[model samples]
Target chain A: MNNTATYHKAIKAATSKLTDIRKFVAKHAREHGFNEKQISDIQLAVDEACTNIIKHAYQFDQTKNFRIELEFDGDQLSITLTDHGSGFDPNRYQRPDLKKQIEKKKRGGMGIFLIKNLMDDVSYSSNNNTNVLRMSKIRS
Target chain B: MKTFKIEHRNSDGFEIIDLYGELDAHTASQLEESLKNLISDQKSNIIVNFRELDYIASAGLGVFMAYIEDVRTIGGDIKLSNMNDKVYNVFDLLGFPTLYDIFDDEKQAIKKFLSDS
Candidate 1:
């Protein structure tokens, strides 16, 4: 059966929107028969992605907005987040050294780390107008 | 939108903050403020009770990371307890098990703080 489908939402680049974003993902993932653990993983990965965009790309500019697109099929789910401000550089991200972060009082790098760990595959790309972070998870 | 709340319970020498509802980037600041106040007040033997927290994002974890060292240096600790499997899984994925002390029960965490002091 061809069960492929797509969903999208455009949200303001503010911390307040994070709850709505998670709800949107959970509502659809449950409808698509994703298990609790799978839904949690996707929700967290997407949350981390959007949080990074709001903080880094738009710098908490509520006037700016971003888009989240999810497309899923029989055995996989994929999410793409697009922002219009300064895009993130994936190469600049080092694996967060937890002890050092604590010692140095750092708190920024863990979001990307969590996104990578929660999603099965993740990649990034950006143009003059758009920066995109794409992540995918396989249903187990 | 789901609401996030923090309720403080005073123990003999430390304090336990019970969290309710979802904790994400939006609600993380509230937790950050609570931790900050506790540290400034020198009430640092902190036990965060996650029994009612249905969800947590990396941002929530970041709040903990930002403050854990401060509390430890003040001769106290921010021990966590009663995390749901989902929340615990996130922490475990980030290798938090080795860095922070986690307890299956709130009493255990309290006991740990008391024993250390």
Candidate 2:
């Protein structure tokens, strides 16, 4: 039995497009038998990942393009975001100290943290001026 | 595509903001602008009603974090109310309960602000 569905789209690297991307992911997650909570978590993770690309990689330059691919296989869902902007190693990323952030009243740095916690697995790779971030979640 | 909208009202010397639709990185700026306007007007005590909010992301949560200190410095606070399970779950997952006062009802939040002042 093959229970796999894949979706791919190329969008401008702009914040305005984040909502649409999240909607696309949520719609497919729902169709793949994900519950409300699971869908919301996936939606948030995708939004954060795209936001990082827009803000950090493309610097909100709408001229750049970011490609998003979503794959659903059985009870597992995977999201891959690719951009032709600045890329870094995900392993070197450090989780912010929640207590310190709250005490210092920090405003940002929670995007990647939330992505790591919400998704079951997260990996990043960049080659030849292109960056790819992949995240997966398995429904229990 | 759902857009985010915020409705502002003044009640009992507190600014009550009603959030509607999805709140993500793109729409969080609107909330930030509203908070800035409120602070400039010296209306810091705020009660954000989230009953109608369908979705929220880290950027949406960041807006609250950005202004909380400024509001608190002036003897005011931002209290949240009427968050559904989904919205509340995001806040809770990020450990927001320790940083902000979350209430079950808007009236309760308003009352707390009034009593504290």
Candidate 3:
């Protein structure tokens, strides 16, 4: 994976940056051995993560921006989505247990759960005013 | 990415389209265009089958939202049936259960619409 991207403060956390990054991944993921199902799953995972950023990252001001990056080496893909607005404890984020929620028809927190299920690896870390979320999947 | 294949059948004042595959950002535009063309031809009372559909996204839901008002205003309706969990979750998230009539099968959806008419 190679690194690339520029960050700018633009319209809160809602920007086309995330979608562009996802499309970038989708395009490159195809070059690897990712099938349609795998691509769609990865797309959805990226979408959910972006949605979360827009919803929870910053204050409701339209003068902020977030950073998103995507990289792929022929065998695997990695995405690093970061927000400078705020940072939260990843350990405190409890994903909804599907087995328990299925019987109750519950909603909410499905984003992280789906992302975790689809991606082979997920990690979160905060450094110098940036909350970075990294997700990846290997072609198998 | 998802592709939609449609099968149309003419009934009394109704036209049913059996849709297959995912309805997401990559494919929602196709479905939207197809629906627009059919509507322009005055074919209404549409029922979309999701038996083979695996998923949908916000963009796909937006397409239905765009057409719902037009179809209903013209005294026609659009119904959905046989949605799997992944696809259904998208609809449920957008509050589709209150906006449109959804059923477990095509027959039930057709009958429900016909009876109302």
Weakest 10 consecutive residues of candidate 3 chain A by summed lDDT:
A2-11
Let me know the DockQ for model 2.
Answer: 0.66
What does candidate 2's lDDT look like per residue over A35-87, in tens digits? 88888889989999999999989999999998999988988988999998998
Sorted into a CAPRI-style docking class, model 1 comes out as high
- Cα lDDT of model 2 by residue, B1-117, tens digit: 345899999886678999999998899999999999998988889999998999898889988887888898888999999999989988998888987899999999988887786
Which candidate model has the greater lDDT, 2 or 3?
2
Among residues 3 or more apart in sequence or in different chains, the pairs in candidate 1 whose N, CA or C atoms overlap within 3 Å are: none
Per-residue error (Å), model 1, residue A113: 1.3
Docking class of 3: incorrect
> Each model's RMSD to truth, in Å?
1.5, 1.8, 8.5
| Candidate achieving higher DockQ, 1 or 2 | 1
How well docked is model 1, in DockQ terms?
Answer: 0.82
**Pairs with backbone N, CA or C atoms under 3 Å apart (clashes), candidate 3:** none
Which parts of model 1 are misplaced by more than 4 Å? none
| Separate DockQ for every predicted complex | 0.82, 0.66, 0.08
Q: Which stretches of candidate 2 lie over 4 Å from their true place?
A: A102-105
lDDT of 1 by residue, A5-70 (tens): 899999999988888888899888887788889899889888888888999899999999999998
